[model samples]
Target: MQTKMGLKKNEIDELIDKAWKGNLERNNVIALYNVNPIILFQLADSMRKKVVGDYVTYVINRNINFTDICIDDCAFCSFRYNEGYILSIEEILAKADEAVERGATEVCIQGGLLEGMGLEDYKLIVTSIKDRFPSLHIHAFSPMEVYHAARTSEMDFRDVLKELKKAGLGSMPGTAAEILVDSVRSKICPHKISSDKWEEIIKEAHRYGIPTTSTIMYGHIESIEDRIDHILRIKRIQKETGGFTEFVLLPFMSKNNALGRIADKRSGIDDMKMHAISRVLLYNVINNIQASWVKLGLDMAQLSLLFGVNDLGGTLMEEKISKSSGSEVGEYLSPEDMEKLILKAGRIPRRRDTLYFMV
Candidate 1:
């Protein structure tokens, strides 16, 4: 078979092999962007099979935005509200209780950096939930949040992560990483930490024995080179600490936000190409590539499975950020429904915890 980029089947297979060997070149990966879509998908799908076979994994989890009040005004945010409501300890516990009731093994907790919120506030939430439900995995906090809390409390990042870990923080979420390039950060989130700072925090968390899921929010004011640079940085970190559990792709949900005024919603073709490219690029480095069902919508998310996605992300029972940004796909999907989507895609659905362990 020949692709539009004038690549043959054997050449595509060699690309897949190169990815598996874990020494992929930048120019080769750049060339993949122009290849025929089907050929690109084939290359990614082959890599996916080598990594995790035919089983598609999903975690039964819930997103608990403890607060939406943030000080930083990100261009891509519609979820930030200066006067947003903050969930009290009892209220947060109730959400955790509800998540456990619905068979959730993990509760993804992340919120805005309220001015007064510090290490104590973070530790309180984690400890409260862990005290109530010893088994629930508290996949909480982001790099920026941690950075803010450390600064607010005048504590070291290590101390903050240590306290959270003692309070039962299962893992950190690699968010607030719009793009790892400094120029993009200056435009999209000027107040946010620099790319070097983000990497420093991520590496610190890794040194503290915490694993995190990596992410990329593409399709807005970023070139293809920017996207590749972001993934390569993640690969370099993985090569160092092996702390990333999975890499997730979040196509920019361009609606009801400042970013939307400048950038339109990404095309379906862009979604396929980005996810497939992520798979092939991070093949041996990050074993799992997750597609965000909330951002991609259920239909495109399933189609991503063929484009080299091995994980369907999580069944987030409650989500605010994406929806506030104009996602009308609703907040929740049941475990049964999650399986049905994977099964219809001709892949086995397995329940997983935040750590990607079969639940």
Candidate 2:
């Protein structure tokens, strides 16, 4: 029987072998559309094992979106609030104290780009957190947020990042990057910063010795070619800067969002395929691939271990963004719970920090 994409049996084997041996060429990966789904999955699983091995890492971190009020209003988001729900700096600090009480070593403090707030507001928040909890790593803000801050404050991007670093900002979370192609960005998030701007902010952060993770939110209006290009773009940047610690694959959540209204629905299988394919394609630049349990349900996230994901992502003590978007997964996980989940998946779980240091 002919496969859905008209893939031959032997060609699938050749691609699988190339990926498994870590010698798959970029052109061959782009030719993946002609391969059988089962063969592709098998190849991805093999490559995952060869590269990442059996240990799965989970970080004890808390995600606190200081305010949900956003200006961009991207179609695929559910976390942004209008204005009334914006949390005060004191309220945000209270949440940080709670996170520290719960054994969080890192706090991912981010928010929508408030219209009038300057860079000093961000610096004050970071300074307060640093002054209170000297040990907590403040993995705050994305390039999108940074760009917005720079635009609002009339300051250079590098200087903005440097100030944040001085205020004890630990790292940058590679969010807000839906797809690195302007074509995709134009359709989904036209009001958001351009792809080049996002890249510039991240590259500038790296220049100031701040490490950042890279993410891709796929399975929406983007084509398969665009997805490949996104990965390639990140790989090129990693080669140039060497600042990316891991690559996270975030499947586009489409429940109450506008994109869901216009496009057909996506499934867990699609998410798994992206995770697996990421591992197969980005062999040179990244060593760790994370499965977002908050986006993909826990079961599929657990199953993703076989598909080239080495990290279970963060045990986010409080996650409002994805959950607000119709994600039914729990908001947080204890280190004990992470261990149980990893053991159930037949792998040993190790606790890690933002730097992937075993804790």
Candidate 3:
């Protein structure tokens, strides 16, 4: 009756039931991995059905990396250069205009931390974009970028977020949150904000009514326990602030990056496990689990539906960060193509805005 890991089968059954109810302990959470893969996936699919039914969602958005010039040298970066390029206001707005022309509902903006790009510079981008296209939702900036700008402007993080929100910032992108474990972050991105600092800034944004998505970058030096810790932290934040819109599982794309040279490579099963376990652990706390199609590749992303993924992220009319890390899936996926992938997976495709509302 005992499995190889020494837990009885009945114990795993109870664990699965507890996971369904969002009550699994830390040890039990790890034990779920040793449970039959089919059973684990089934549990996730069942959870997805109860939470979101058979509908799969995707945002028709674009990624605008306004600058590639960064100061911090993260070991996992393949996108930064000393003084690469910084788009002017006219150039940024022009990209927005092109995005609008191509039927994008939102524009996701993020880039490196330049020396003098302070709060005023950040606000200028938001305000000008809003002024030009009054209807476009601007999902921009990471917590680290906020911290950097705050330091540069000699302003508090809350004050920076308040200014950006006032300037039409729709939401914040939860990047720069690689593993959220201080140990892992120390190795991958030593100069980035600490995990506790990241939490403080995120909670501040949520308290101020600025919603943000949560993310984790795995498949590198981080252990499965590290990922669970990251997930629990997200769940705790949602419990306290009710701010996270969705939880995104971003696998580490290990190519053309320094971290890749020494990081562990994940198998196909690992990708599915990350999605399935995230769904089981998150349960009702964070209902939407997104699988990044660009990083997972189209086929793997589509396969994730059975593993409890309900969102395929965005069309990403243009994506550079992942591309720089050696993603060869190209930069775009049309709305029609998005729907086809969802339909092929036997789920209904629902077009969504940045905030997950039907468009």
Among these predicted structures, which one has the highest lDDT?
3
Over 4 Å off, model 3? none
How do the residues 1-359 of candidate 3 rate in per-residue lDDT, one tens digit apiece? 88767778899889988987778888888889767788789999999999999999999888999999999999989899734999999999889999999999899999999998899999999999999999999999999999999999999999999999999999999888889999999999999999999999999999999999999999999988999899989999999999999999999989888999999988989999899999999999988999998999999999999899999999998899899898889899999999999999999999999888998
Q: Give lDDT: candidate 3, residue 248.
A: 96
Per-candidate total of colliding backbone pairs: 0, 0, 0
Q: Is candidate 1 or candidate 3 better by lDDT?
A: 3
TM-score of each: 0.96, 0.94, 0.98
Name the runs in model 2 displaced over 4 angstroms: 1-4, 7-10, 17-26
Task: Point out the higher-scoring one by lDDT: 1 or 2.
Answer: 1
Give per-residue CA lDDT, model 1, range 81-181, as digits (tens).
Answer: 93479999999999999999998999999998899789999999999999999999999999999989999999987899888888899899998888999
Best by TM-score: 3
The deviation in Å at residue 306 for candidate 3 is: 0.8
Error of 1 at 111 (Å): 0.7
Score candidate 2 by TM-score against the native.
Answer: 0.94
